[model samples]
Target: MSAVTAPTKGTPAHRRSRARGPLLSKRLRMAGLYLAGAAVFLFSVFPVYWMVATAFKPVSEIFSGTPSLLPGTPTLEHFDRVINGELIPGVSFWRFFANSLTVTLASVLMGAVLSLLAAIAVARFRFRLRTAFIMVLLVIQMVPMEAMIISIFINFRQLQDATGVQMLGNLTGILIVYTAVSLPITIMMLRGFVAAVPKELEEAAAIDGAGNWTIFWRILMPLVAPGLVAASIFAFITAWNEFIVALTFLGRSTDYYTLPLTLSYYFGRYGTEWGSIMAASTLLTIPVMIFFLFVQRRMVSGLTMGAVKG
Candidate 1:
């Protein structure tokens, strides 16, 4: 055998190049991945950035012959117009905001509570028609809302006529509809969360002289709080952004209009008010962003935690 030789401090160019090749390739691959991620991020965020930029731009810049990435002079005139001017003949922006707030809160609250209770029953108990109930939920969720809206409206009108509850032309009608629409999926999602919690915890609590209610509220609820927050976010967004049902139910009553309905006002036969539209759209996104900021951690955790057991 020839004399064994090790690579010294000063190695040949080819050897050095071969040794460094993988590191250099790895760095290049990382750079390429980062560039790809940046491209996707820009693609996703550009529309939102454009909407906000347009919102701050003056009417002259908005309608300019040449397009601009930045506003020439930013102005709050569009926001002022949206806020100060009436979207409907007699209704103010605050009125519509309040209506949306009330409806969203009520539906989320009612739907969340109902979903939690139903999910617990389905997850923990052995009863007749349990599997059937789950199947029904799945079937109902598969059916599109458009297919059922006509029947719902007809039935709601009859109910209103019989009960004098004004179910067809009021916030209550929409609130009920929103809750029902969100229930099936909410229940399905929460069932996974409920099943993930150990029954041993409840048994231990019971052994320690805790009642059923105490065990449920103190031990179980805190564990599933993330799931609750996630479900509430879904319910809140659904109720907040629902347009067709709100428009159908509210009809010509502008007093009960939500933010989504206000976007329609900026369009007219003569010309569309692009500036005011963007401003109002920007304003509309703020509440959702604020809500997401508060609950984002919980939402992510809830989805992960529930998925573990499911």
Candidate 2:
């Protein structure tokens, strides 16, 4: 009689699965994802890290033969030069800072409001040419800013000539241009967000006798708050960092110069003030960092809530 052999735990099928199991496969995938994410973060953050490091670096250390990750010997000489207006005669850092603040904040506010209204209308209304309007907005967004810069310049200049109002380089002009430029994309983004919110919620609110404004402020705004914050951050950053239009418009007027133009005035044909430039750039970055920190929580909440609920 032949004895029957039982299958061991180390059988080929069992061993093969143990070696290439779901758990191991999952772990490998997770590891790869983590590595890719780390690489991306390092790539994105390194320039900002370098900028911060260079801002604190001494002129001698910056030009030194050996480059360092950290400042070799830190000094506030550059910062002092920038703050005390010792670098350029009659240049006011605070005034330029104020100009940037005014323009960026105003543009952000206007864009948010306009985007909110336009998005709501697009999402809710069934009007003639609605699709056409959306298509036009898409087309406008596709066009590069550089391509339209010349036409925009000419139109604004003609408007200025006809009205005898300084529209190109002035604060109001820049604010309008920035808001107009930002509106199409902002509206499109918000339209999608508004559409994502269930229509039943608005109907329920209306059934409860809630006015349009109350329903919007109480129900809808909170839901779309994250998108609003993200849009505001985009608008603020754009308006603050925008150099070309600011340069073209504010070039003739020194008193009306924003932070970017102020930086240009710091440089000269003969030599560049690298230290002061770095210091001023670092200073300009402070507000942007602060604003992002403030709104980041809301933005995250908005995005996460959407994903979880939707």
Top candidate on lDDT is 1
lDDT of 2 by residue, 144-235 (tens): 77777788888888999999988976787788888987787777767767887887998999999999899988889988887787778867
Show the colliding residue pairs in model 2: 169-249
Q: lDDT by residue for model 1 over 1-310, one digit each (tens)?
A: 0111243433464355446778677457557867999999999999999999998999889889997999889999988987998656688888888888998999999999999999999998989999999899889877887788888888888999999888866688899999998898888778878988998998899999999789979999998887888888877877888888887777777777777865665454214678878888888898888888876765564445445542
Cα RMSD to native, each candidate? 7.7, 8.4
Backbone clash tally (model 2): 1
Candidate topping TM-score: 1
Q: Once model 1 is optimally superposed onto the true structure by TM-score, how far is the C-alpha of residue 223 displaced, in angstroms?
A: 1.6
* Cα lDDT, all candidates: 0.81, 0.78
The TM-score of predicted model 2 comes to 0.78
